[model samples]
Target chain A: MIRSAAGLPARAVEPVANLWFTWRYVENNLGDITTALSQHVTLTVQAVVLALVVALPLAVLAHRRPRLAGPVLGASGVLYTVPALALFAMIYPLLWDPRTTVLIGLVMYALLVLVRNVLVGLQGVDRGVVDAARGTGIGPTRLLLTVELPLAIPSIFAGLRLATVSTVALVTIGIIVGYGGLGQLLYRGFNSQYRAEIATATVLTLLVALVADLLLMALGRALTPWARGGR
Target chain B: MRDDDVLGAAIRWLNDPLVWQGPGGVLARTVEHLGMAGAAVLLAAAVALPLGVWLGHQGRGGAWLIPLTNTSLALPTLALLMIFASSGLGFGNRPTIIALAVFAAPPILANAWTAVREVDRSVREAARGMGMSSARSLARVELPLALPLVAAGLRTAAVQVVASVSLAAFVGGGGLGRFLVDGFGTRRYGQVLAAAVLIALLCVLVEAVLALGQRLLTPVPLRTGRGAVARS
Candidate 1:
């Protein structure tokens, strides 16, 4: 007989297939599952938004100064190299809340991609576009806003999409801090050798990543009607 | 809580003579970690290298695979390890290696595929004009030129495997993750930090070696600012 969480004996005879997925377990655990999912989405959104806020000014500054670009890109590469678990472990002792620690780690991981993409996109603004704007008596600020930034939107969106999906996947690593969202289920499932939890958690994490990527793609499409027409 | 005290405790843990001995020592764990990570990367390269190269030489169909591979680069490491280890594969290294190898393959495959295709058209034309067979042209002419990117992809895969091998601890596989899992389980925060430090250093070491290798692989002509500059 298998023991339940309450230490009661469960029926010894059960269908082997039931171990793979059980609708009853999910139906009863809706509250925990939903809570995990919401926390995951919340964590991913906050991290990406914060990363963009930080990456934007730095990207612009680097784009303006070629000398600064190398160091900026180099630093991001190093940051990205810091593995998720190691990053979390290093940060865990310094921070009080698990969520905040994870948030900081996720932001640092994303900074490299976001800054690199933004810099590339901005630099790619056709030199003729800037020259034409200047010839029409546009100020530098107006030139950047009207001509350069809009053109960079496609590349910027690409970075955001990547960052969002990766963060969704990486959020699972935050289980060390008890904040790994659906990763809680995965970890627990492993401890108990519960097939349904492991399978469901894995499938759900993929779904979350896929859904986030699709949403970002739709947002990008809506933002850039011109990208579609040009192709 | 005093952060300095935790740091001090971690320093103590790092220097402990006992922690450096026996089946569970830091040095042993590091070696285990490196061995497993290396195996995973090599395994991935074996499968991905041929497929990626073949698809790249074909030149048309595998365009779709790039995005698919990039997405797979974020394969949920923790979850996959658990699933594999539990799937009648028996506990420990077998399952962990399979999962880690799967995680490591995409970057290599994508890189090999893209690098082959990116070799200049004129270079291929020259190889053709020399009466080189398709196999010979791909082997002798295209691959050497594509070495820089292949090296880059290998470096990415290797570093990534080193970085994530700590997860093997979760599956009863002995490695540096042993320290992490044990420390966290026992609430020994200092040990956890010490393990983190060890892992980060390992990552840095792997990255340095790969960077040197990539430089050596890159021909003098292709060394023209592609890697150093952050251009798209």
Candidate 2:
């Protein structure tokens, strides 16, 4: 029996087992586990969408005015250099909301990859293609939408793939600030010295990452079939 | 602490080698971080370079490997660190080193593979026609051509590992990250600022050194073209 600090009877620690026991434990608490998984996905999806909305226009603006691109990209790189925990702590005082910390960190991560990729993708469009579009007397808006964007989609998707992977990895850090996810399970397992729980969480996180990676690869292939063989 | 006091203390510490003392002392700490970084680079080179060479030579496996490497490159080091550390792994410098080595591998591998594969096929064929063995041709013809791009990739990986290793301080595997963590805990803003400054300076210095190395290593005059310009 494990004794309480106040001098009660001692209590026995739980026995360890193999993978099957771990699986059974997890299965018993599947509801909590699924909720945690969904929370992780929700956080990642929300952050990526929010980041694209902000970064896309910024990329276009920077492209139109080439001089601005350096400063914009530089600023984002600086933000990228700031450690995730520091970023959360830095904003904590201003926002005073723990719930948004992961969101904010994810957005910051997205900016570095997404903005640069978008700019590169846009700039990388064949000059001949753009010139021909202009020669055809297409409006600037029409050319940008039809020709420039379609060509740039490959680069944009590359950035999205990167951003998605990063977001999933970072969402794990949200566990520190009391947000729920696999990180929560990992953290709990660490504190409790529960090897089973730790392994379960870790494997689950890797699976999430692998699944996200495969999905993005498929999407990338679909969108940029031409680039498949070229690269 | 007042800004003036903090600045004065920092200036004093800069002149004080005592603050840097440890096993190898200040010099040791410096060497240790360098050694750790160097080991990681060496390990990454060993794993990534060969894999890259094979992928570059074969060119079939890249469909899976390229994206996999890219995804790995973007993985969050801190989260990974925590996961590994918490597994009763008995964390310290070794685990941190391993984690960082893994962190640094993908960029070097990806770049090396791409660079090797990208070498003009004609160059390889010509070398082979001269009765060079496949191995000899790879070493003399392909690797020489691939060196510049692979160097660039290594440079990027170096910077990344340096930054990521600083997080190891959180696991009680001391480095300059010790100063950053200590500063945060004790509210010593000056220490935090100094550590940040040192890290930034180190990154810049490493980049410059790698750039210089690239210049020295490449056999061909650096090309001034869109590809070179884009990479820079």
Candidate 3:
């Protein structure tokens, strides 16, 4: 078997190199990592934020009309079931730019998870609480805003957490489309047989996901103080 | 670039008899994709089912297990696949299977764990009152009740593995994804479109089959209960 520079067999030519040594290579490519990380973060944040915007109205509509919930969820579920790599490839030709395709694909994937969570959160509000408020003549808009919305924050944040972590991971796959955060390193490193670069990229990508997850968890906790102990 | 042009070309490519008759044909690639994905799901189920069930029955370890599994969602499958491929695993099917198995395990584990744990404690107690041992109670009462959720987890893992295995082509593994890679490399837009369609159809099929299986596996009583309605 041909061996890579790291003395690893090059049978697949895509193996991860040694970690300590990979650190040196990673240091040398800090600038590239930074660029990719920024791009990755930008795409992830943008897709998720956009998904939240689009999903909220849909979720509200579904919540208001219980029957609409099934079709709304089913449509998003169909999108979610589409293979990520295939979806990106299918949309790539139409969009021309990898970034746009990645953005669209990520947004589509997030919609189902986010919308479902929002619906769950809204539906989870106790009927007794709603009835009590109604008995006091609380207006619909005020009730939805001050009571229901706050109650739903926890579930919505849970969805955000799930969406963010998965999106970060998915962004790495975007390397196939010519865009990825640390994913660029994995692909380039694979082609060049640089195991260290692959290791560095993989580690950083994981770290980014970890951090995003933790941040969202904290945000969820802060947003729903009542749920802190329960969580 | 027109939509109709791409659609027409893809349909033509898919219908061409020559595309299904050879070693690298769509038939072969579809089987390859199924084999790789199926192996991963099988592997994940093997590890996750027993562990999740045991933990759930014991009512222990969930505090840590759930979080750990949740955190694993952040691990990139491609990165994991590459690492396995480069580590002298000879890439393609072996390493790809291993990585895909790892990718597919979390959902099954988490779902199964939750499913068994969520089985009605009253049901378990009633079984025990009838002189059933702990193991017997779990097997007779809990397992039956938990089967639906366990099946749901299996369905989740199966769909995920099938969809993600497209990357196997990039890593020296045989699969329908090869068409996408090869097509993109050679600028054969038809092949790319065809591959995308096949992968999507494959995922949808797996989902439908599993949904049926889940429905069938559920106990009749459970199937008609509030729990089933809530889950659906």
- Among all candidates shown, the one with the greatest lDDT: 1
Chain A TM value for model 2: 0.87
Q: Which run of 10 residues does model 2 chain B get worst, by summed lDDT?
A: B223-232
Tens-digit lDDT string for candidate 2 (A67-135) = 999889877755665556445444433444567877887788887889999999999999999999999
| Candidate 2 segments whose C-alpha is farther than 4 A from its true place | A1-14, A17-21, A24-39, A70-102, A126-138, A173-181, A210-231, B1-31, B54-64, B74-89, B182-197, B225-232
Local accuracy of candidate 3 as per-residue lDDT tens digits, B105-165? 8878888888899988898889999999999998888988888888888888888899988
Candidate 2 has an fnat equal to: 0.11
Write the residue-wise lDDT of candidate 1 on A1-231 in tens digits. 679999999758756663878897799888988998888889989999999999999999998899999899887877677788888888988875799999999999877789999998999999998898899998978888888888899899889988888898899999887889988989888988988988888888888888888888888888788889652
Candidate with better DockQ, 1 vs 2: 1
Ranking by lDDT: 1, 3, 2
Q: lDDT: which is higher, 2 or 3?
A: 3
What TM-score would chain B of candidate 3 score versus the native chain B? 0.93
Q: How displaced is residue B83 in candidate 1, in Å? A: 1.1
lDDT for every model? 0.85, 0.72, 0.84
- TM-score ranking from best candidate downward: 1, 3, 2
On a 0 to 100 scale, what is the lDDT of residue A29 in model 1?
84
What is the DockQ for all candidates, taken in turn?
A: 0.68, 0.21, 0.66
Model 3 spans > 4 angstroms off: A1-21, A132-138, A225-228, B1-4, B225-232
Task: Identify the superior model by TM-score, candidate 1 or candidate 3.
Answer: 1
True contacts kept of each: 0.64, 0.11, 0.75
